[model samples]
Target: MPSLSEVISCLSDYDPNALPVAQAQQIIRDVVTPVEAVEKVALRSALDRVLAHDIISPINVPQHDNSAMDGFAVRGADVGPDKAATLRIIATIHAGGGFDGEVQAGECVRIMTGAPMPQGCDTVVPQEFTQAAGEGEVTIPAGAVKTGDNRRLQGEDLKAGKPALAAGKILRPADLGLLASLGIAEVPVRRRLRVAFFSTGDELRSIGEPLDPGCVYDSNRYTLYGMLSRLGCEIIDMGVVKDDPATLSQAFRIACESADAVITSGGVSVGEADYTKQMMAELGDVTFWKIGMRPGRPMAFGKISSNGRNACLFGLPGNPVAVMVTFYFFARDALLRMMGAEENRLPLMRVASESPIRKKPGRTEYQRGIVATGADGVQRVRITGSQGSGILRSMSEANCIVVLHHDQDTVHAGDMVDVILFEGLV
Candidate 1:
């Protein structure tokens, strides 16, 4: 693994004080290493887990050539383009059943959906498209269906000995069904990432505790829990640690010793008197930075070692909104990488701005927004009132985040702005 400084040295324009958001993201990606341990999990328990190995199909999907719908199976040669043809219904074949005898010319088997195609039959004529001519016979009109119509070819969905799901894929509901179809009862997936997180401050208190004269409830840990839980991480909520040196040092050491990554939500901004910053610097090769982004400007990222065990550290800002923004933009991707999951960055959707937005160049801005579609079917986004970093309610009330990129200026009404939908992230 490359040291944090070594990775930063490779960048041509590395700036500790005013790092661009994208540049900081790239640096964190380059420094962290993925976990190597793998475990066999039941197919039902594999959802959202990263696949440690490629899943190979043992048998062809559908197993054999079958009917695609409830229709009659007939030879295409019997139905001509010029006129209708009547054929004798030799047998009725339902799903999971096949004809015992060969289907001769002018003899069509009545095949239902998912039924295997009988011998000497290729096309299927829908019962509605055909009329009963006489006893045990049906007529197919011209141009109703041609050769191979409604017939599911063997191995069309998936072929045997082929890659069904590639390595590094985060399994979903559909993936589970696919694996079950291939007779995969167990899957090799990367072990769930262990993440230890806590909030650091002298003025913060847990919910059950009585509020002191200058103390407020600690909401960062709960928010972190929700976000980390969505990522499927094995979370270790270490509660709130005081700003004292001994307590902060012990928390850092214990977190590094217990988890693959450690996250703290305070004492990272400039000119802070708290010991959280000092303890982080003394314990590891952590770098504090003033990121060029709104709602989340100050952050620290590096590796910390405790009793020979090391874990990646992410020290975020103290404000509730800043903590959430920094986690989603920075720590979220890093933890996903450590879990051996593929990089699946959230897509930025461009929509019209409902009103003018004040912005300055050289710094990126993440403003809470409410997006709705107009009666004309045009999607437009409006800011959710005030966008203060300390105001957590803005995040709760908004459905999306309007992202004004670095080097971009103010946005005029009706201008197309990039947005990250909360539905995709939360």
Candidate 2:
């Protein structure tokens, strides 16, 4: 296991005070390791679980050569490019049936879709292209389908002993169908990650508690719960912890001892009277960072140990919107790694802006925005009214987060900006 200091020492431009977003992401990836535990799960229960090993196809898909269309199976030599040919229809083959008799020259068989091709037949002409001549003969028009046009070859979909799905893939609906097609009853997958999270502050209260003059209901835990649930983690919601030194220390120790990763929102900023920072430093090798980003800035990342058991730690900002931003951009990938899953970062889309955006050049900004299609079919994005970190309503109303890069200046109207959609993240 590599210490956080050892990892940071290797970086050439390591600055904790104003670390770049990209640099912080890379550091997190380098310091964390994937879990090695595995479990066998039934196919129905394997959805959204990461595969522990590559799935090899046991049998060839489409085991035999079959017809892809309902038509007449005939020899390629029977049809010509310039002239029409008439053939006698000898047999009619349905799906899942085959012809045992040889098809002679000037002879064709009526074949349905998914039916195995008859012996000595290499092409299929659709019923619409051929006209019926007499009682059992059909006329093939010139320039009809070419040879081998409507036939599905054996093992085309999947060959025996070939890899069907790679390891680290998160199983989805289509994956389940593919596994069923290969007759796989169960699969090996990584066990779910155990995550323990809580919010810390004396001014925070639960939902049922009465609102005092300076206290407010704690909303960060609920948001964190929803996000962690979507990731398929075994969550341990530790609720709200006060700012007392002994209470905070006990919470950190218990969280690290019980879960694979510990996440907390609040008590990470500089010059705070609370003992959150001191307790964190005493517990393990943790570093506080003020990243060059908007909505989320103060954060702490490291490994903490208790009773010889250790877990990764992430201390996020206390504001409602800031907590979500920091988690999505930082802790999400780290947790996925701990679960032995592949890198599944949300993709950024470029869309035109509906109006000019005020921005500085040194820091990155994540402004909530709604992406919609214009009357001309072009997609454009406009910021949701105010982007304050505490205004959780804006985050709920917007469909995407407009990402302005660190070196980018003010964005003019009609300029293209990168955005990560909520549909993908949630």
Candidate 3:
């Protein structure tokens, strides 16, 4: 494994104090490595797991040329170009059944969808396009179907001896069905990543705890648990650690010992307590940075070691919204890499803005937005009421995040802006 310093040395323009969002992402990508462990899991249990090896198809996907509709399979030469031709229907073939005899000229076979094409038959005319002329006879109209029409050719979906799925893919529902189609009962996948997270503050209390003056219930840990669970990580919720040097140090050590990554929301920014930062510095090669991004700016990132075991650490801001934003933008990809998953960045779509948005040019801003189709039948986005880092309600009410790039200034009401949607059609 390459050290963080070695990775940083390779970058030409690296800054720890005032890091660009893109640069910070690149740095994290270069420093993190995938975990090297594999386990065989049943196909149903492998959903959301990263595939460890490429899966090659053992046989053609369709296995043989088959009918794609309920129709009469016949030789193309049997149907004339200018007039309808009547042919004797010799046999009927269902989905799992096959015909043994060859289909000769002036003869046809009634075939159901997915039935293997009989020998010497190349085209199928749908039952709706054909008429039962008499007993055991069907008439196919001229120009009903060309040769090879309505037939699913062998190996059309996936060819034998070719890769069906590549390594590092996070298996989804469709992937499971694809593997099932290839007769794959078990799959090799990387083990689930172990993540331990906590919150730090003297004024933070857990649920059911007595509320003291100036203390609020800690929601960061609960949010982290949900997010990590969605990513298929084994979570170790260390709860809220008190704002004390020894207690924080002990919590950090314990987290590093048991998990592949550690996350804490609080104590990394200026004006907060210094013990968390001081202890983090002593325990690891962590770098605290003020990222050029809205809602999430102050972040601490690096690897920390405890008793010969090391884990990646992400110190996010104390604000509720800021913690969620930093986790999604930075830590999400890094953790996916650690788990050996190769996923592309979520696509940002362009849509018109419903109202003018105030933004600065120096920092990237992610404002919560409500995307809706207006009376004009065009999709447009409007920002939520409050974009403050502490306003978690804004995030809940939003269906997407309106992204303002680092070089962009204020946006007009009708201008197109990029947005990342939280919900998808699938």
Best by TM-score: 1
Write the residue-wise lDDT of candidate 2 on 1-426 in tens digits: 688999999988898999999999988988898888999999999999999999999998888888889999999999978899999999999997878999999999999999998999999998889999999999999879788889888898999999999999999999999999999999999999999999989999999999999999999999999999989999999999998899988999999999999999998888762466677778998889999999888999999999998999999999999999999999999999888888988689999999999999888899999999999999999999999999999999999999999999999999999999999575
Overall lDDT per candidate, in order of appearance: 0.92, 0.92, 0.91
Tens-place lDDT digits, model 1, residues 222-261: 9999999999999999999987789888999999999999
Full ranking by TM-score? 1, 3, 2
Misplaced by over 4 Å in model 2 are: none
Off by over 4 Å in 1: 273-277
Number of clashes recorded per candidate: 0, 0, 0
**Residue lDDT tens for model 3, 1-426:** 776778788878787767889889888888888999899999999998999999999999999999999999999888867889999999999999999999988999999999999999999889999988999999998888888889999999999999999999999999999999999999999999999999999999999999999999998998888889888999999999988888999999999999999999999888773666678778998788889999888998889999999999999999998998888888999999999988657689999999999988988999999999989899999999879999988988899988899999999999999998988410
Q: Which residue pairs show backbone clashes in model 1?
A: none
Model 3: residues with Cα > 4 Å off, grouped in runs? 424-426
Candidate 2 structure lDDT:
0.92
